[model samples]
Target: METLSLLADGFSVALTPSNLFLAVVGCILGTVIGALPGLGPSNGVAILIPLAFSLGLDATAALVLMTAVYYGAMYGGRISSILLNIPGDEPALMTTLDGYPMAKAGRASDALVLSGVASFVGAFLATIGLILLAPMLARIAFLFGPAEYFALYLLAFSTLGGIASNNQAKAAIAACIGLGISMIGLDNNTGIARLTMGELHLMDGVDFLVAIVGLFAVTEVFVFIESHGKNSALGVKLGKITIPVKDILRCKWTMLRSTFIGFIAGVLPGAGASLGSFMAYSAEKSLVRDNSQFGKGDVRGVAAPEAGNNAAAGGALVPMLTLGVPGSGTTAVLLALLMTLNITPGPTLFTDRPDVVWGLIASLLIANVVLLLLNVPMVRLFVHILSVPPWVLLPGVTMISFVGIFSLSGSTFDLLLMIGFGAMGFFLRKLDVPTVPIILGILLGNNMEDSLRRAMVISGGEWTYLFSSGIAIGLWVAAVLGFVAPMFLRGKIRKPQAITD
Candidate 1:
C-alpha cells in the first residue's frame, strides 16, 4: 500500500507538463539514436547529458529524461536489427538472429510491430518488478558495513569484466586506467594533491562528464571519420505497419518467461541486457520441441530477445538505484549522472529523496506506455533515421559534444582533455578494450577506497577483519565466482549468425 502511494506521488511528478514534454522529446531522440546502428543508449544518453545540465533541469526532471531515453533506446535497437541485420547496440545483437530473417521473408512490418509489443511487455513488467524489488533490496543493503561494501564493490569490478569484455585481462587493464585517472584529484582525507602533476585543474581531478563525453560521445565521431562516413546498408522496405495479434498471443508465454529471466539477469550486478537477451533466446530454443525455425524467422525468436533485453534494461536500474552498483554498462553511465547531480544513490536514497526515486519509477512507467504508442505509428519515421547520411549526422553529434562540454565548465582544457580521451578511447576500441569497466572503475574507485580505509580503521588495520563478517565473506565469494562464471558461460552460449541477405 505504501508503494502504491509512493507510485501515485511519482505519477503526479511525471505528469507535470514540463516533465512529460521532456520525456516525449527524449523518447523520440532515443528512438532515432537507437535506429542508427552503433550509437546505442550509452552514447545517446551521454550526448544528451550536457543538454540536460545546460537546460538546468532539476534532479528529478533530468533523471526522468535520461531514463526515458534509456527505455526508448531499448525499444529502438530492434529497428536496425529487423531492417538491416545490424544491431543498434550489443544487447540488440540477438534480435538480428530472427528479426532480419522475418524482414527477408517479407514480414518486415510484422517483425517491427511484434518486436515493439514484446519490448513494451518486457519493459512494463520489468518496471513493476523494480518497484517491488528495489525497496526490498535497499532495505537489505542497509545492513552492509564498510567491509561488506568494500567486498561488494570488489564483486562488481570482478563480475563486470566477464560480461563487459571478452578478455578479463583487457578489462582489468581498463579498470586500472580508470582507477589511475580517478586518483588525480586531492585526497579527501588529507587534502593532499596526488596526481596533479603541477596543473591546478588536475587537483580537482578529471570530471567524469568530460571523460564520458569523450569516451562515449566524441569517440564515435572519430570512429565515423575513420569509417569515411559510409552508409552501405541495403535497407529493408516496410509494408503497411500492422499489429500481429495472433503472433502476440502466440508469444505471450515467451514474453513472460523472457521478462522473468531478463529481470533476474538485470538485477545481478554486471550481468546486463546482452546476457539477458542471449539467455532468453537460448532458453526459448531449448524449451521448444521444434526449434528449427529459431534463426529462420520464427516469431517466438523475435519476441523472446526483444522482451528479454528490454526487461534487462529495466532490471539494470535496481542495483544502480539501491546499492550504487550499476548492473550494466549503460547503468554505469546513469550512475555518473546521479553522482554529478549531487544525489548519492543508496539505501538512504529512498528516505532522503523519495521524490527522485519514486518520480523516476513513475516516469519509467509513463515512458514505457509512451514508447509503445509512439513506436508503432512512428515506425516509418524511425526507420528513415537509418537512412540519415553519416556526413550530416556526425557533424551534429560533434557539435553537441563540443557545445555541451564547454557549457559545463567553460574550460577549454576540459575540451582538450575530452578530445584526448576520445583519441585514447579510439585506440582502446581498436585494441578490443572495453571502456565501460574503465568508467565503472573511475566511478567506484573512490568509494571503494573509502570503504576499505574505513573498514581497516575500524578493525585496527587487521587484514582478517576484511573477512570477519558473513556478508563480507559472501561478497568475496560472489566476486570470485562472478569473475569465473562468464568464461564458461560464454563458451556454452551459441551465437546466432545475423542474416545478411
Candidate 2:
C-alpha cells in the first residue's frame, strides 16, 4: 500500500509537463551521445551539469533530465553496437558479439528490435526492483550509527577496487589520493588546513564538479586524442525494425533471467553495467551449453546483454540513492550532482526528499518508454552520430565541460583546477588506476571522517569503539574479506579491465 502510494506521488510529480518535456529531450540527446564512439552516459551527464545549471533548473528538474539521459544511453548503446562493430558504450560491448554478426547476416533489423525490446524489459523490471528494494535498504540504513556507517564505508571502500575493474591496489591508490585531496579544507577541531599547500583557494577543498568533469569528460577527450581516434562505425543496411514472435518467445526466459542477474550485479559494490551485461551474456552462453550461437548471432546473446545492462542501470541507482555509494561511473557522476544540489543521499533521502527519489524512479520508468519509442523510429538518425567528425565533436565537448565548470565557480581558478585534474586523470588512467574510486573517495571521505570522529567522541575517544558493535564487526570482517580475498584469488578472478578500451 505504501509503495503504491509513493508510486502515485512519483507519477504525479514526474508527469508534470515540464518534467515530461525534459525527459524526452534527455532521451534523444542520450541516444545520440551514446551512439558516439567514446561518449557514454557518464560523459553526457557530466558535460550537462553546467548546462543544466546555466539553465538554472531546480535540483529535481536538473537531475531528472540527467537521469533520463542515463537511462536513454543504455538503450542507445545497442544502436551502434548492433549496426557497427563499435560498441556505443561500455555495457554495449557484449552486444557486438552477436549483434554485428546478425547485421552481417541481414538480420540487423531483428537485432536492433530485439535488443531494444530486451533493454526496455530489463530497465522496466529493474525500476520495479528499485521501487521495492531501495525502501528496505534505506530503512535498514536508518538504524546505522556512526560506527556502523564507518564500517559500511570501509566495506564500500574495500570492494570498490573490484568494481568495474579488478585492480584493488590501483583503486586503493586512487582512493587515497581522493582522501588526501578531500582533506584540503579546514579541519573541524582546528581551523588549520590539511593539504591547502598555502593557497587560499585550497581552503575550500577540491570541487566535486571540477573533479568529475576533468576525470570523466576532459580525460576522455585527451585519451581520444592520444589515440588519434577516427570514426570507426561502418554503415549497416536496414529496412524495417521488426522481431519474429518466435524469437521473442525464445528469449522470454533469457530476458527474465538476465534482468535479475543484472539487477543483483548492479546492487553489488563496484560491479556496474559492463560487468552485469558481460556476466549475463556469459551465463546465457554457459547455460545454453553446446548449442549456443553466442559468438555468431545468437538472439539470446543480444537479448541478454541489452536486458542486463539496462537492468543494471536501475540496480546501480540503489546504493547511490540509499547509501551514498555509487556502483558505476554514471552513478558516481549522479552522486556528485546530488551532493552539488546539497542533498545527502543516505536514508534521509527518502523521508527528506521523497520528491527527488520518487520522481527520479518515476522518470526512469518513463525514460525507458521514451527510449523504446525513440530507438526504433530514430535508429537511422542515431547512426549519424557515428559520422560526426572528431574535430567538431571534441571541441564541442570541451566547450561544454569548460562552460559547466566556469558557470559553477564564475572564475578561471576552477577551470585551471579542472585542466590539472584532467591531466592527472589522463596519467592515472594511463597507469591503470581507476579514477572513479578516487571520485568516490573524495565524495565519501568527508562523511567517513566525520562518522569516525563522531564514533570516537561518543566513546570518549576509545579505540575499541569502532569494533564495539556486532554490526560494525560484521562490516569490518566483510571489508577485510573484500580487500583480502582478491589477493588469494588473484589468478582466479579476472584481471582488471575497463568496460571500454
Candidate 3:
C-alpha cells in the first residue's frame, strides 16, 4: 500500500502536460536513433544529455526524458535487425539471427509486430519488478560503511570487466586507463593539483558529460565515418503491417520466461542486455523439444531476444537507482547525469526525493506504452531510416555532439578534450578493446578512493579493517568470482552472429 501510494504520487508527477510531451518526443527521437545502425541506448542517451541541460529541465523531467529514450532505443533496435540484417547495437544482435531470416521469408511484418509485443512484455514486467525490488534493495545501503562501499565498488569494477568484456585483460586495461584519467586535476583530499599538466581547466577535473559524449557519441561518428556507410542499403520489402496475434500467443510463454531471465541478468552488475539476450535465447533453445528452427525464422527466436534485452535494460536500472552502482553501460551514463544534477542516488534517495524516484518509475511505465503505440504505426517511418545516407547522418550526429558539448560547458579546452577522448575511443575500438569499463572506472574511481581513505582514517591505518565485516568479505569474494567466472561462462554461452545480405 505504501508503494502504491508513492507510485500514485509518481503518476501525478509524470502526467503533467510538459512531462508527457517530453516523454512522447523522447520516445520518437530515441526510436529513430535506435533504428539507425550503431547508435544504441548509451550513445542515444549521451547525445541528448546536452539538449536536456540546454533546455534546463529539472531533475525529474530530465530523468524521465532520458529514460524514455533508453526504453525507446531498446524497442527500435529490432527495426534494422529485421529489415537490414544489421543490428543497431550489440543487444539487438540476437534479433538478427531470426529476424533477418523471417524477413527473407517475407514475414517481415509478422516478425516486426511480434518483436514489438515481446519488447513491450519484457520492458513492462521489468519496470514492475523495479518498482517492487528497488526500494527493498535500497535498504541494503544502510548496512554499508566506508569499507563495505569500497568493497562494493571493487566488486563493480571486477564484475564489469568480467561480464561486459570479451577479454578481461583488455577490460582491465581500459579500466586502468579510466582510473588514471579520473586521477587528473586537483586531489580532493589534499587540494593539490596532480595531473593538471599546467592547465587551469584541469583543476575542476574532466567533465563527466564531456567524456561520455566523446567516448560514446563522438566515437560512434568516427567509427561510422571509417566504415563509409557500407551496410546502409535496405533490401527488405515491407507489405502492409499486420498484427500477428497467433504468433504472439504462441510466444507468450517464451516472452514471460525470457523476461524473468533477462531481468535477473540485468540486475547483476555489468551483465546488461547482451547477456540477457544470449541467456534467454540459449535457455529457450535448451528447454524446447526438437529445437531445430532456432536460427531460422522462428518467432520464439525473435520474441526471446527482444523481450530479454528490453527487460534487461529495465533491470539495469535497479542497481543504479537503489545502490548507485550501474548495472549496464547506459545506466552508467544515467548515473553521471544524476550526479551532475546534484542528485545522489541511494537509500536516502527514496525518502528524500520520492518525487524523482517514483516519478521516473511512473514515467517508464508511460514510456513503455507510448513506445508500443508509437512503434506500430510508425514502422514505415523507422524503416525508412535505413535509407538515410551516411554522408548526411554522420555529420548530423557529429554536429549534435560538438554543439551540445560546447553549449553545455562553453569551454574551448573541453571541446579539445572531447575530441582527444574520441580519438582514444576510436583507437581502442580498432583494437577491439571495450570502452564501457573505462567509463565505469572514471565514474567510480574518485568515490572508491574516498571510501578507502575514510576506511583507513576510521581504522587508524589498520589494513585488516577492510575485511572486518561479513559484507566487506563477501563483496571481495564476489569480486574475485565476477572476474573469473566469465572466463568459464563465455565458452558455454552461444554467441550470436549477424546474417549477411
Candidate 4:
C-alpha cells in the first residue's frame, strides 16, 4: 500500500504537461537515433546530455527524457538489424542473425511485429521485476560498510574485465587507460594537479560527454567515411503488423524462458543485454531438437534474443537504482547523469527521492506501450531511412556531433580532444579491444579508489580489513573467479587451434 501511494505521487510528477512532452520527444528522437547505423543508446544519450542541460531540465525531467530514449532505442535497434543486417549495438547483434534472414525471406513485416511484441513482453515483465526487487535490494545495501563497498567495486571492475572483451589483456589495458584519463583533472581531496599537462581545459579532466561522443559516435563516422559511397539495397517491404494466434502459442514457452534468462542476466552486475541474448539463444538451441534450423530464419530464434535483450535492459536498472552500481555501458552513462544531478544513488535514494525513482518507473511502463504503438504502422518510415546513402549521411552525422559537442562546452580544445579520442577509438577497434570497459573504468574508477582509501583509513592502514568481514571475503572470492573464468574459457576455445598448428 505504501508502494502504491508512492507510485501515485510519482505519477503526479511524471504526468505534468512539460515532463510528458519531454518523454514523448525523447522517445521519438531516440527511435530515430537507434534506426541510424553506428549509433546506440549510450551514444544517443551522450550526444543529447548537453541539450538536456541547455534546456534547464531538473533531475527528474532529465532522467525521464534519457530513460525514454534508452527504451526507444531498444525498440528502434531492431529495425536496422532486421532490414539492413546491421546491428545498432552489441545486444542487437543476436537479433540480426534471425531477423535479417526473416527479412530476406520476405517476412520483414512479420519479423518486425514479432520482435516488437516480444520486446514489449520482455521489457514489461522486467519492469515488474525492477519495482518488486529494487527496494528490497536497496535494504540489503544499507548494511554495507566501507570494506564491503571496496570489495564490491573490485568485483565490478573485475567482472567488467571478464565480460567486456574476449581478450583479457586488451580489456585490462583499456581499463587502465580509462582510469588514467579520468585522473587527469585536479584532485578533489588534495587539490593537487595530477595530469593536467599544463592545459587549462585538462583542469576539469575529460568531460564524460566528450569521451562518449568521441569514442562511439565520432569514431563511427571515420569508419563510415572509409566506406562512404557504399550502400546496402534492401527490398523488404513492411506490411500489416499482426501475429497469428497459432504462432504465439508455438513460441509461448520460448518467450517465458527467454524473459527469465534476460531478467536474471540483467540483475547480475557487469552482465548486459548481449550476454542475456546469447545465453537465451544457447539455451533455446540446446532445448530444441532440430537445432539445424535454429539460425536460418527461425521465428523462435528471433523471439528468444529480442525478448532476452529487452528484459536484460530492464534488469540492468535493478543494480543501478538499488546498489548505485550500473550493469551495462548505457546504465553507466545514466549513472553519470545522476551524479551530475547531485543525486547520490544508494539505499537512501528510495526514501529521499521516491518521486524521482517511482516516476521514472511509471514512465517506463507508459513508454513501453507508446513504443509498441509507434512501431506498428510507423516501421516503414524507419525502413525508408536505410535508403539514404552513406556518403550523404556520414557528413551530416559528423557535423551534428561536432556542433553538439561545441555547443555543450564551447571549447575549441575539447573539439580537438574529441577528434584525438576518435582516432584512438578507431585504433582500439582495429585491435579488437572493447570500448565499453574503458567507459566503465572511467565511470567507476574514482569511486572505487575512494572506497578503497576510506576502508584503509578506517582500518588504520591494516590490509586485512579488506578481508575481515565475511561479505568482503566472499566478494573478493567472486572477483577472483570473475577474472579467471574468462581466461579458462578462452583457453579451451584456443586449444584446437594450437593442436592443429
List, residue by residue over 1-501, the lDDT tens digit for candidate 4. 877887788888888988888788878877777777777888777777767776778999999899999888887888888887887666787888888888888888888888888888888899888988998999989888888988887777677778655777787888788777888888866888888879887988888777877887788887776766544534546766666556556778888899899999888878878787777777887898777877788888888888898899999999898878888888887887887677888888998999899999988887888788777667777777666666666677678778878887899988998898889999998888878777877777777777888889999999999899888899899988887887878743221110100
- For this target, which candidate reaches the highest TM-score against the unseen true structure? 3
Scored by lDDT, model 4 comes in at 0.80
Off by over 4 Å in 1: 231-236, 488-490, 493-501
Please say which candidate is ahead in lDDT: 3 or 4. 3
Q: What is the C-alpha lDDT of each candidate?
A: 0.89, 0.85, 0.89, 0.80
lDDT of 1 at 351: 89
- C-alpha positional error of residue 381 in candidate 3 after TM-score superposition, expressed in Å: 2.2
Question: Candidate 3, which segments miss by more than 4 Å at Cα?
Answer: 494-501
lDDT score, residue 322, model 4?
Answer: 81
Write one digit per residue (lDDT tens) for candidate 2, span 1-501: 998888889989899999999999999998888888778888778888777877988988888899998998888888878787888788888898889899889998888888888999999999999999999999998888999999888887787775445678888898899887888888866677877779888888888888888888888789879877664554546777665678878999999999999999898767788878987887888888564577889999899999999999999999889988888888988888888787889999999999988998998889888998888756767766777766678778988899888988897889999999999999997898888788888888888899999999999999799999888899999888878787777665553243342
Residue 324 lDDT, candidate 4, scale 0-100 = 82
Q: State the lDDT at 388 in candidate 4.
A: 65
**Candidate 3 per-residue lDDT over residues 1-501, each given as its tens digit:** 999999999999999999999999889888988888878889888888888888889999999999999899999999989988889887898899889999999999899999999999999999999999999988888789999989988888888888777788998998898888889988889999998899899888888788888999888778877888788765547999999989999999999999999999999988889889988988998898868998898999999999999999999999898888898888999998898788998888998999999999999999999999988866887888778877788788889998989999899999999999998999999887889888888888898899999999999999999999999999999999999987998876433444465
**lDDT of the structure predicted as candidate 2:** 0.85
Tens digit per residue, CA lDDT, model 1, 1-501 = 999999999999999999999899888888888878768888888878887888889999999999988898999999999898889877898999999889999999999999999999999999999999999999999999999999998888888786656788898899889888988889977889998989998998998889988998888888888988654454557899888999999999999999999999899988888888988999999998889999999999999999999999999999999999998889988998899789999999998999999999999999998999888877988887888777777788888889999998999999999999999999999898989888888898888888989999998999899999898899999998877877888776433333354
